[model samples]
Target chain A: MAFLEVASITKQFGNQLVLDQLDFSLEKKQILAVLGRSGCGKTTLLKILAGLVSPDRGSVRVEGQPIQERPLPERGVLYLYQEALLFPHLTVEENLGYGLKVRKQPKPQIALQTERMLYDLELSAHARQLPSQLSGGQRQRVALGRALLVQPRLLLLDEPFGALDPETRSNMQLFFKKIAQQYQITAIFVTHDLKEAVNMGQQWALMEKGQLTHYQQLKDFSKDPKTGLQQEIAFWKKIDHQL
Target chain B: MKSSNLLSIGLVGGFLLAILFLAVGSLATEWRFPALLPERYTFEHWEAWFQKKAWMYYLVLSLLLSAAVSITAVCLGLMTASGLSRDKRSFLWLRLSYLPYGLSPVLYAYSMQFFYHISGLAGTWLGVYLAQLILVYPFAVVLFFTYFDSSMHHLEDQAGSLGASRAVVFQSITLPILRRPVQTILIQLFLVSWFDYGITSVIGSGQLKTLTLIVYQYIGESNLIYSSLASCILMAPPMILWLLQPSRSTKQDIPV
Candidate 1:
């Protein structure tokens, strides 16, 4: 059975249908990148998976067990926002230790794990600094580290690097890809950037006007003229030819 | 003059005048009209006021009342504001929360007099506390409603999805992020309750004697020295709280 299965999800806001019978599934430790424009229900889909929002009609199963009406804590899903929403009052170390502490892990174990995460995220030097003291890239790293430390069964990213500068965004993308592989994490990354989706995801999906179109491979995604990758490639190719 | 410059000057002028009055009124042993300066200066009035057991009782009572009111209001406000912020359907009733704050406290007290009489809370300390709570909790709600932005809701949802229970989410995420704003609201509510006169007077019915009432009585009796001493006592805690406020540098880094 697939690690995660989402079937026939439908949602509406008043008279506006925001999600229309969307269906997808993922294998264990696989990453799916969802590409879409604004108001295309990509975020809504992620929220539904994270248990932050409910679908009007759908069944989400993890490990073949239905997750419908399950509480967030029981669902074991986490969502990362576009902006790094670190706890401003806590130091980086405290932020990293929050999940373990909440889980009632032993003090020494929590400290050890937090220390390892800090080193892994290259945030050891910023252990005592508040979120405001960290740079944008550093803050995002801390947020990612905090989420990863929780060891959720499924992680959902909503343009997690959308606010970073180009250099920082690229660096974070590479870092995410590396850590996700190292930890064998299952995630669904949502982005408006086509390159970002192609770079991070093994499979790709496009959402438009509350409908989703899934592609099994990069070639399949690029070949579909309706997905807009073909037009983007043609435009770049024309520019190269002129040069 | 630029408005900012005018505002600065006005604030400084007001502060200086307050200090001058407090100093003169608390120290002057004799100062007849037409004299720019006091004929004599002494700290006897302040010393005597501080020594009185009645003054201490009133001060402690005032502190306890303010603390109780602030704590209750903030707790209620946090719950109400969080619910209202998460659900747009509750917004229609949000304006109703402001009704208590918008109306005069004395008028509100009059309207609740029948309930107070029947409940036997009309002239007790509990009655005064409840009255002040009714007056200040609405402000607390408004403050928290405005203070908590949409990002906070996102953070809350994220925490919940991270396997944190509702209590854990509140303790680890909501409370930590809202520490500064909550502190600010508590202090504001404390000050409002500490300085309240109308509702306290009407509800207490001469039974509960808080510092404000004592000060008012002193002023009414034309006793400037005792009134000034009471005013100094009233201002001490808030002044200390203001001095202990987090620096601008520390405040700059709060996550949006």
Candidate 2:
């Protein structure tokens, strides 16, 4: 059985069918990158998996148990938005320590874990600084640390690197892969950038009009700029037109 | 820390000036230069009311009722705001709900009396409270909706991913972040409720009389000393809360 099972989940917003019994199953500690154009409900799917939204039909199961009656936090699902969602009132240390604080972990363990996360993410010195004081890369690192601090089984990333420039984006992407490796956490990252989808995960799923139309191993997909991803590129172009 | 901020502070001073001018004619009863200060500092008039045995209870009841109304209204407002924040359009409904504040308090109170009376709430603590709730709930909703809507979108999601139950998320994410706004709303609702004579006079007339209504009674009787002393006494609780407030971190936040 898959560690996380999303079986034919259906969601609708008014008369529009946002998701039509979308079925997806994934292994534990594996990375799945969801690639889709704007308004295709990639974010919405992640939200459903995170238990942030109640689906109109179908169900999600974790570890083979139905999650119908469960709340999002109990499912150990974390979502990272495209923009950093750090609390403006908190310092970087406190922002990263928030999940730890919520779990009511002892102060010392929080300190040790935060220190290690800061070091791993190269955010040690800026611990006392506020989020407004950090650069884009630093802010994203703090966000990652916050997600990892809880030791969540699933981390739902919603295009968290969207705000960074190319240089920072690539750097944060590599850093994300490293943390994902170190923690061996399951991550479902949503992005429209094809390069990000390919680079961040072993598997890639294509979403269109709130439906999952394609799924593949990243290595199986070709990356040649001239001919590669032509179908996806064209599919997104049409979707953009519709949007 | 902007020029607009300085302008707002200047406006608070201007409000105090307006209040002072409201009573300037009392000073005109005797000659006073510039008519800014009262003709004579006479405490015996309003102070005599304070000296009465029953007067303090009005102050006590007003404080208790307003505080309760502020807290209950805030919780209700928070629920509505958090629920409504999921959609962008729900804000229009929330904003439109504030039409009560735009109406004359006396008319609103009289109109609402039937609802309270039929429910067996009038002349009862809960009745008077619900009356104030109706009048002030919009303010609570407006204040907390602004505070919670923008920030809470991602908050509950994050909390849930951490093994927190729905109740846990509500407790952990919604409540902590709410401290600052709750403190602010508490003071504002208290001030609004404490000074509100229309609803008080209607719902709490004999069952309870707040310092505000009593002060108004003396002012109508042309009893300046009684009105002034009662007004001063009535203003004390909110004044103390405002003063004791900022030292607490939650009370000191800039609206941003």
What do the candidate models score in CA lDDT, each in turn? 0.85, 0.77
Scored against the true structure, residue B154 in model 1 reaches a CA lDDT of 70
| Per-model TM-score (chain A alone) | 0.97, 0.90
Mark the regions of model 2 whose C-alpha exceeds 4 Å error after superposition: A104-107, A213-216, A223-243, B1-51, B84-96, B99-103, B111-126, B236-256
For candidate 1, what is the DockQ? 0.62
User: Where's the lowest-lDDT run of ten residues in candidate 1 chain B?
Assistant: B247-256
Runs in model 1 lying further than 4 Å from the true structure: B1-13, B26-32, B37-52, B247-256
* Top TM-score prediction, candidate number: 1
Model 1: CAPRI class: medium
**lDDT of candidate model 1 versus the reference:** 0.85
Error of 1 at B120 (Å): 1.3
With candidate 1 superimposed using the best TM-score fit, by how many Å does residue B237's alpha carbon deviate from the native?
Answer: 3.5
Which CAPRI quality tier does the interface of model 2 achieve? Answer: acceptable
